[model samples]
Target: MELTNIGTVRDILGRHGFNFSKGLGQNFIINPDICPKIAENGNAKKGYGVLEIGTGIGVLTKELALRADRVAAVEIDTRLLPILDETLADFDNVKIYNEDVMKADLRGIIEKEFAGLRCAVCANLPYYITSPVIMLLLESRLPIDSITVMVQKEAAQRLCAAVGTRESGAITVGVNYYGTVKQLFGVSRGSFMPSPNVDSAVIRIDLNKKSELTEEQEKFFFRVVKAGFSQRRKTMANSIASLMGIGKSAVYSVLSELGLPEAARIEQLSMEQLMKFSVMLMEQTKE
Candidate 1:
């Protein structure tokens, strides 16, 4: 059955006496085309393992299980287990766990279930937990090859935003350090049951093996980026001075050495420029 067949989903939930919980973000995708697109973009073929979050009504999970060798879907709402079991019965490869994705030990789960197979993450993420969930997957010790998620349109733009753009912020810079991000396509509000107030977009994050900096350097660079965006209206120097407890004169000196104007805002610096500024800050501290 395709995801667009909402009647089936409704029937299954009705049988189990399940009520959609607003807190869990229980919006079900009723667009069959989106299922295949998400699976294809995630590159989840046979022999690959997939970690799925927020598997509401098993619409997307059914599709993922068909494509991937093994699919582990973590759902915080235990009430939906029977419903998922009924909907996803034929797929022996699918495993449903009743736990919060944030609290689960992903490394242990992957090691025990997936073993040596390449892994990808797929989700129709809740708007509230989207940022933390994506960050958790990217920062995990597991071998996550890629991530394809459906998030609110605004959130998607922020994730794929380029440095020096209005949308760029700490999350944008942080994601860029780990991988390449792209907005795949947008989904209309009407495509989902109990439709969201806003539209959503699908995004892909391809992990990178070679980082330009050592672990320490990457950490320091992000620290600076976070501090830079801590006060959006303040100049970059003022923001860094306030966050890092450094003098405004010293911050300006570092910006001058990097050939950036003294009045430049934090939004004006790219990830590369941020790293260079971090190095200059270290040198100044040493002097």
Candidate 2:
């Protein structure tokens, strides 16, 4: 059977009486070439373990299995299990895990399934659950080499947004603190079985091997980041002051000490500036 063919996918679903869940944000990629592109851009390697989330009909999973030493494809939809079992029958390296990624013990599973191999995350992530999934993977600190995901185009832009730009959000800042992010490619809405309203794009984030940040400093950094981004239109100092329980004058004083304008918006600061601000704030809190 042509797994990436829409007719074949429909036939498989028909045989099993499987229905697409709107709540699940289900969209299966039906383009054969697209899967290989995602797998290649994700850096799936001969000796690496590729973690695949949202394995719709096992198209991308099959592609990853061809490259990676092992592929742990996690699917939340129980109905697709039989279809996956059939389609992935030929692939010995692919293992399907029937579990919710949000609730799974990912670290434990990675340790047992991946073992000594380097690991990367590759997924056609659901739009509704994209942020938490990506954030969980990043914060898991699981010795991940890279995270390559296909998300909504707008989301991809916000996630891989350039520092010091309005496109950057708190999530973008948080993501950069862990890895270097870049846009891999754009996948159109037409590529999927059930076409979505907006287009999608792929992003690749290579995790930083080392950061010049202490654990205590990291805590303060994110705290400040959270506070600054609490309100998008507000000035950085004002927003941070409101959320951090500090006086606006004190916030402005620190900004002036760093040679920043009192009117600077939260999105205007780069990752470097945020880190520097975190250090100064840490000193002030200590005093």
Candidate 3:
């Protein structure tokens, strides 16, 4: 029942007929170093409740159980439940839910399972569903302390990229608004049972800072961000105008007031600059 051992993983999967689902991003880690490091990167200290998503055969889930007070893992693929049961049978602290993390009542789950304990999220996020999953976790504001995840190297770079860089996408801006991200370590493409084409990197996101704007303002601010990034090829004025449903002249005026060029690209603007400009634009449209 040693989940990180390649022979054990193969044995369990073969017994259950558990075929990997590319759509689910089902690449299970066989590297003994990777799973423990991922759990460590999660900051799963005593008394902390760690929630894991995509718990393939309960590998990382088992690691979290050793470090945290409670480990709740979500696995959308029910086919792996028997495997997880066999692998995780010894750990009394781990709970594997045959449920989708996105659709589950996270707040309620946290409240019920993690009462009096600090919460953190640790996952090997499914690549195709990464954006929505991260967005849901951030927006939930579920009294979580940190989020440490393993993502494709490119995605890792994009998520942790500095603001005002062209590497910053809408998700980058959105993630930056919510938490401070730091790169932890890289896992070679060869670390998995069925290796992914690209190497993966682990990143830790601490939910330390709160945005200066209120929730409603922040909502509209992200709307402005979407507008800014809507058409990368277009000038700021053009893109913002089209998405914000405002006039190009008005957008130009707003940029002028902000001391930015009307032709500025949204990706070139920092989160602070985006927030300042978006607040102004939102106010102007109201008037």
CA lDDT, candidate 2, residue 282: 78
Q: List model 1 lDDT by residue over 1-287, tens digit each.
A: 55468787777777788887888877889878898899989978887999998898888888888899999888999888887777788899888889988999888878777876889999999999998898888766468889999999999999999977889887788688788999999999988998989999999999975677777776777678888887977898788888888788888898888889999898888878887888778668768
TM-score of each: 0.94, 0.96, 0.97
lDDT of each: 0.85, 0.87, 0.86
Superposed model 1: Cα runs more than 4 Å off: 1-3
Clashes of 2: 0
Two-way lDDT contest, 2 vs 3, winner:
2
Instruction: Output the better candidate (1/3) by lDDT.
Output: 3
- Each candidate structure's count of clashing pairs: 0, 0, 0
- All candidates in order of TM-score, best leading: 3, 2, 1
Model 3, 68-123: lDDT tens digits are 99988888888888887788888888877788887998888788888899999999
Estimate the overall C-alpha local distance difference test score of candidate 3: 0.86
Which regions of candidate 3 are displaced past 4 Å? none
- Using lDDT, give the best candidate's number: 2
Q: Write model 2 residue lDDT over 13-110, tens digit each, in one string.
A: 99999999999999999878789998998878887999999998898998999899999988889999999988999999988889999999888878
